[model samples]
Target: MLDANLKAQLQTYLQKVTQPFEIVASLDNSAKSTELKSLLEEIASLSDKITLKLDGKDERKPSFALNRIGENMGVVFAGIPMGHEFTSLVLALLQVGGHPSKLAQEMIEQIQGLDGRYEFETYFSLSCQNCPDVVQALNLMAVLNPNIRHVAIDGALFQEEVEQRQVMSVPMVFLNGEMFGQGRMGVEEIVARLDTGSADRAAEKMNEQAPFEVLVVGGGPAGSAAAIYSARKGIRTGVAAERFGGQVMDTLSIENFISVKETEGPKLARAMEEHVREYGVDIMNLQRASKLIPAAEQGGLHTVEFESGGKLQAKTVILATGARWREMNVPGEQEYRTKGVAYCPHCDGPLFKGKRVAVIGGGNSGVEAAIDLAGIVAEVTLIEFDTRLRADEVLQKKLNSLANVKVIKNALTTEVKGDGSKVTALVYKDRATEELHTIELEGIFVQIGLLPNSEWLKDTVALSNRGEIEIDARGATSVPGVFAAGDVTTVPYKQIIISMGDGAKASLSAFDHIIRNS
Candidate 1:
């Protein structure tokens, strides 16, 4: 189960273990259990401080617990931790063996100080790129606070539990057997949810801050670039993002980023964040902007209101809020979301293995999803509203070659049919024949495109009919001293490189306005 190169790396990582720990595994005579045992034995062979025990009795077989010597830290992995979760396993071992985490000191203290019992069960897939963050975050928290226990279960391995819970997405978290959240979430966001007073405290702290020379709203590539460029000018810069990394975090693979051969979304987002942190920009994460109030006077500070009731003032505001996945908005869609309807093929595709699924849209994303799902799912129905698929020739050809995939063009998704607990079928209308068709499927993946997150600026700034913030070449919006960039604005192409360039241009334009007005 363990390769030579991987074993050597694991041995190197285990050298940092300062204390003794044991792997308590619950196993049966299953193939996965045997594989898991082999992996655990290889890990234990690397370090003398590590011990493996197969005498455990957990209802979830093929599961294991990384417990500190004589202490039950309550961190469990129900399936073999490979693929994306392999890093999570390594980190758990080191942290449980007394190695320190790289988490901020402030956050460490917050996790340790958090009161009440939090029994978190996060269901994830091995192929999912976003599951590690949530698993590692919760594992770290469990290691820090005894009251907080986390069990990262592989949904594929625990299909019964997943079906009973009506989970159709990766990284679906349940707290005390109740649904906590779904999708990507960081430690800060998790802590904020558990500690209700954190919001009030954060809001109060924001109220005491001085007005920034450049305040960037959103923390995608655009916001990060804008912040870095503005901070390089030696001005007071700040960035308040609802969730730093934005849509980029949801992206699975980024091949056309330019220069870089290949990279994943979360990895690129981390690098961008670290680059921005090198500057003097004050970044406020998990801060949602509810409204934008322009400055009363020409040289006055503009106020950006937050959903948490926190407000921040800035001389010039750069909107880089980016975009979110466009929804089908058809009947039963919202009701079946996570019950069977999902947007991300990379994240939620594994849950539909051996099942029939539908991919809405015929663009690159839709075609790509159909191709990817063809390998895992029993069948993939690619439905396109356009007369033909708009994907690249190569992708369309590849999708057409797939035996398990079917393409239906000029079909408009009308309604998502579900059995109250999960999706059962999808309804669509044929544009040419004006006939309604229903395709029975277990899941629906919406991959149409993105919608700009510019609803808050609809009333304050000049917006296009499509709700994008209107901006000129200088990135200046209709409101003086206010600028927009990236997907939120009326930009032509919503590429990462283009967004970064737009961000830098907006920052420079904002600086020019500031100097002239001053």
Candidate 2:
């Protein structure tokens, strides 16, 4: 199961384990046990010092325990570690089997100060990119204190359990059998939860957030960039976001951002976050914006509310909420998403190279995608629901120039056909003739128009017909003291570089608003 390079790396990492540790597997001898057993045995086989202990035929669900012979190190995996979460398992093994934690004394003390026994169960999926961050943080918390016990449940392996628990989202955490919360969380956030005397602690903290001179809603490149700029102004700045990275996290490869020749979405996202952290930005991450209330009276601060009942007041606000690709709610579309149905051509185009693929939508994105995919894929079928292509003339010309690309107008994508493992074909219906057609393709790229994440602000701020927040060149909205930027605004060409510039402008404008009011 372990490849030669990976095996060598694991063995090398395990060599640093100063204390004798056992990789224990508690199983009920079920089908799920078979898969986990194979991987565990393989890992244990690599190191002579490390041992694998099997507690077979256990009444409880399958779980992996990391510990010494008698003492339980407090880290247990209730699910198989695979997918994007695989790295968490590797890191956990090394951390649990090693010496004292490298965490600062303050952080260690914070974990130690927690009062009661904390038994955490985190449910996650393998494909979720944000799941590992939550799992790792909880696992580390457990490792630092014997009173803290964490169980990382792989949602895929424990489907029935997840369903029974009504776990609709990955990284859903349960503390002492009660739902804690969901989404990505940091170690400090967990500590905050523990520091809370009651379960409503998170809500209380949210309601008690300090007012900011500048509040940047959203944490994508634009929002992060805005927060950094605002923080640099020496003003009280805050940023609220569901996830810090936004669509940037979904991106795979980026080549046209400037300066940097090539990069990945998540990598760039990390850099953006690091840059923001360098500033004095009060980042309220994993907080979703639900509503916006304009400052009624002069000098009154505008209040921004979150889905979690968290609220922040700011004299000036910068709306940098980003955009998302519109999805075709067709059969097998969600099932095969990330498998074969991709939204970004630049991200997943290379994987479809030499394979037949279909590009849905004929706007600039669709035409551009047709041109981009034509160079890589064997055959590119560009489908549009309209009678004519809505893309720019230059893009249309470039797409037409490509021999391998074919454009079909007045066609609506009806279904994304897949074979459980991957996409195999695309189904479409001709709008004009009402003729249904199926195209054999390995990949389906949806290039439909992007939808701005400004629904919550539609009534509060001036919004365009397309649901984008309206803003002047200075990032000032129609409402005073409110600024809008990024794809959520009425900005042309919603590229990452442009959004970053927009964020900077919005932040600077927010600073200006503050000074003028002062």
Candidate 3:
């Protein structure tokens, strides 16, 4: 049951409901069912427009559905949607109760106009920071379109289904009983996937638009800052990103962002995005830039190509694609990626509960993952190529104190061994004696550092040996009117605060270049 403070907050939120809705529970006589019933009763008590029914025909025990009165808007929660999913639950209630969503008018119309029936089931962990996005997006779609149905299932609560489906990752979605995708996805991405002709339509629209003064090529902190700065200067600005928030969306806790003592990655990303939207910037989300076409002449328009067959031209371009987790490229790593190997411990660690797992790094991320997994998993083996752990002293001390963790130094992860179905063990080599060792485990968490998202620009811009864009102090690249910032650049210390400063500097530099050339 919710505490007093939470109950008061829920009451305020429930007051936003404009129409009547039903909460139908399909629960058995278990303790979890009782707990869920209590939660439901407390919620129904808050608003006069809400009604709760305990008798339901849903086969999934302890599950509930929120349906509009006399409408077939299908949105179900297969478990007690607490933790990160608590927001999903609240949003579902309000939306089902006829509260308008804040999504753009264009997107809302598109969802409402979609034709076929879509039954989407998403498996998620309550602790997963990324799961709520997919859940909420689908829930919103289900509410908007009576033809669409979405069920957000808790993987931890439904272990049997998880094993049957071979779901090794959180936020895995299935459409009509077929695997759809296995990662974080927003509403736009989902629409693009469902609507096959959307890409061509978007491409045509982009071709018709006028060239921008500043076109940012990412939507992370750096690109957002650049867009904000450029837009504030009374110049045309636009941002094209595969997904807004970038790698920071995958990050869990962000304590080092200055001034803000502590905040979650998704929260900061949203705040940054909202700040950018306050300006006259045009944000194109779910867009992947496949190629960078520099302007042929100085002060002319630069062309950026997208995977969707769309191309946008800008006078000045800022590349801030950011970075992604570096994968362990050992043999069988790719084969067992979702089956056993995972990059995010915060999201996927719960799936391997009470099972042996291995962490494939010795830095802060790996040590932190090991410490966090120690409680839920049976055992954790931390392997490091270096002789000593590269984590901070405090983190290393805490990692050493864990009873279920074992640290292996001077060891190289040689290969990932797995059956065709799932991971069986991990093979490693001792650097000191050239001896091989295999640890039987159910999962492998790779916590290695990040790789710059600079592959597309490698041929176009001056890059370091590590493939990071080489930039001057002014944030200007070798190409005229083309600048870079954030983790994709040769900037030291890849932090959010530094990225924002770099983005602002790059935008200023781009502005100065434009003025000088004009």
Clashing pairs in 3: none
Superposition TM-score, candidate 3 onto the true structure: 0.98
Q: Scored by Cα lDDT, where does model 2 land?
A: 0.80
Ranking by TM-score: 3, 1, 2
- Per-candidate TM-scores read 0.98, 0.66, 0.98
| Candidate 1 overall lDDT versus native | 0.93
lDDT of 3 by residue, 135-254 (tens): 999999999988999999999999998999999998999999999999899898999899888888988888888999899999999998899999889999999998899988988889
Per-residue lDDT of candidate 2, residues 1-518 (tens digit): 56789888888887877777888788775877888888899888877767888973333467788886678767888867876667788878777776565565966888877878888998876656667778888888887788999888876566667556755455678999998876567686688667764325545776787788988888898998899888888988888887788888766568998999998676788789888988867777767788888897435989888877767898998988798888899999998776677776654564454779888899977888789778878999999998999999989888888899888998888888877777788889989888899998888888898899888876678899999898898999988999988989888888899999999999898888888878
List of clashing residue pairs for candidate 2 = none
Stretch of 10 with least lDDT, candidate 3: 292-301
- Model 3 gets an lDDT of 0.92
Q: Report, for every candidate in turn, its global Cα lDDT versus the true structure.
A: 0.93, 0.80, 0.92
- What is the per-residue lDDT of model 1 for residues 1-518, given as tens digits with 9 covering 90 to 100? 88899999999999999999999999999999999999999999999999999998999989999999889898999998898899999999999999999898999999999989999999999888888889999999999999999999999998888888888998999999999999888999999998889999999989889999999999999999999999999999999999888888888788998999899888999898889889967889999999999996434889999998899999999999999999999999999998999998888988998999999989988898999999999999999998889999999999989999999988899999988889999999999999999999999999999899988877789999988999999999999999989999899899999999999999999999999999
Q: Which stretch of 10 consecutive residues in model 2 shows the poorest summed lDDT?
A: 196-205
Stretches of model 3 off by over 4 angstroms after superposition: 297-299
Instruction: Give residue 120's lDDT in candidate 3 (0 to 100).
Output: 100
